[model samples]
Target: MNKVHYLNSHVEKFREDIKITIDVENIGDLTHYCNLHIENKKVTKIFTECFHKKETYKDLIKKLPDTVERLGLFYLTTVYWIAYTCHYHNDKFDEAMGHCLDSIDMDVPLLNSPHFCKKVYYYLNPIDEVKC
Candidate 1:
């Protein structure tokens, strides 16, 4: 199978897994956000067109590292968004916090928001630490 086709299949499976694991109500919003970003980034056109030529497939393989990094960022962003939504709206604060902390523990670049950082810090180092 061509690399593009293989990558596309894996992505589709991941999407399916996300749909199964995420709340049904949230799936529509997540799909809309992802589709909007894909359209704005022109990533859809690139992947669709790249499969037509052998050279294009090879080129994609050569750029695999960058592709993987972008994909990782996409996955992380999705997880972060779900965690944020769950924490604030779904009353799944502990689960959401665990997801966020797991992401951080993976040593990926941290989210830049101070509010998120503060929440995580407080989560790790509870209020009792300073109460005494």
Candidate 2:
């Protein structure tokens, strides 16, 4: 079994209606996985696993439309985190920027929009040197 190293994980109340829990882990060899659960009037859970050797960034980005369809306006933070992790580990900043722009195009307010905006800005202008 591949050992998992968590990059980040947290649980928090999102807005007044939803609570979100997210776990992002690197399951060895640059493979990344995210497990996210959101609870409001109903329960929604999603698991996305990407293997670096087997998947290209384009493949990862292609899943966004389906993800947005499934999750609607909720839990995009975890998606952004997964994108950031994929880029950071693979040095694929340009693809990361594309992922961020696509997420923004969904045009819903994220639980932490400012934080996500900062990440997008850093991807556009790395001279600012903000830590993700």
lDDT of each: 0.42, 0.39
| TM-score leader | 2
lDDT per residue for candidate 1 within 1-132, as digits (tens), equals 999989967866655322224443343233223422342233323332333232232343343345434443343344344444453446665455567677556322233443444445444434664564
Which parts of model 2 are misplaced by more than 4 Å?
Answer: 1-47, 51-57, 65-111, 114-132
lDDT of 1 at 13: 62
Pull out the clashing pairs in model 2. none
lDDT of 1 at 108: 29
Candidate 1 regions with alpha-carbon error over 4 angstroms: 1-80, 87-89, 99-110, 113-132
TM-score of each: 0.22, 0.25
Q: Write down the lDDT that model 2 would get.
A: 0.39
**Candidate achieving the largest lDDT:** 1
